[model samples]
Target: MMAMTQLQSGDRAKIVDLSRVSELVRRRLLDMGVTEGVEVCLKCTMPLGGPFMIESCGQCLGIRRSEAMRIQVERV
Candidate 1:
């Protein structure tokens, strides 16, 4: 498994773990359909270490770099 932040644009992965992040972040992710077993794709990454744009469950979300660092994912 690797941190979500490690994924480059166009990379596809499945969420495996969300335990490393705080409960608030976990809750928000879950609510956004970013739970374990869900497939996610790196859509876009801003320059200068900005938020990452990922697509999951037919929705796109921009997550902070800090939260992305804590999300674990396996390549699919």
Candidate 2:
């Protein structure tokens, strides 16, 4: 498994763990259909350490790089 931050734009991966994330952030992720077992595609990473845009369950969500660093995924 690798951190979500490690994925390149257009890469697809399956979520493995969100254990390192805070409850508030985890809840937000869940509300956006991002959870373990879900397949997500890295749409793009904003320039200069900005947020990352990911597509999960057909929805696009932008998340902070810090949060992305805590999400674990396996390339699909």
Candidate 3:
């Protein structure tokens, strides 16, 4: 598994694991349909190394760089 932050725009991957983040964060991600085995795509990232736009389960989310690094993914 690799950190989601390593992915570039247009990259596709399947969620492998979520880091040992807080319960609230885990719940929030799960609520948003970000779970293991789900495929997600990196749509784009903000300039100056900011948030990342990721698409998953027909929903688009702008996740902060720090949070995104906690999401581990494998190339699909």
Q: Which number leads on TM-score?
A: 2
Of 1 and 2, the candidate ranking higher by lDDT = 2
Residues 1-76, model 2: lDDT tens digits: 9999999999999999999998999999998878999999999999999999999888999989999999999999
From the highest TM-score down, the ranking of the candidates is 2, 1, 3
Candidate 1, residues 6-62, lDDT tens digits: the string is 898999999999888889888888899789999999999888989999998789988
Residues 19-60 of candidate 3: C-alpha lDDT, one tens digit per residue: 555667778878998888999999999989799999998899
Query: Which residue pairs come into collision in candidate 3?
Result: none
TM-score of each candidate? Answer: 0.93, 0.96, 0.89
Against the reference, the lDDT scores of all candidates come to 0.91, 0.94, 0.87
Off by over 4 Å in 3: none
Clashing pairs in 1: none
Candidate 2 pairs with clashing backbones: none
Tell how far residue 61 is off in model 2, in angstroms.
0.4
Better of 1 and 3 by TM-score: 1
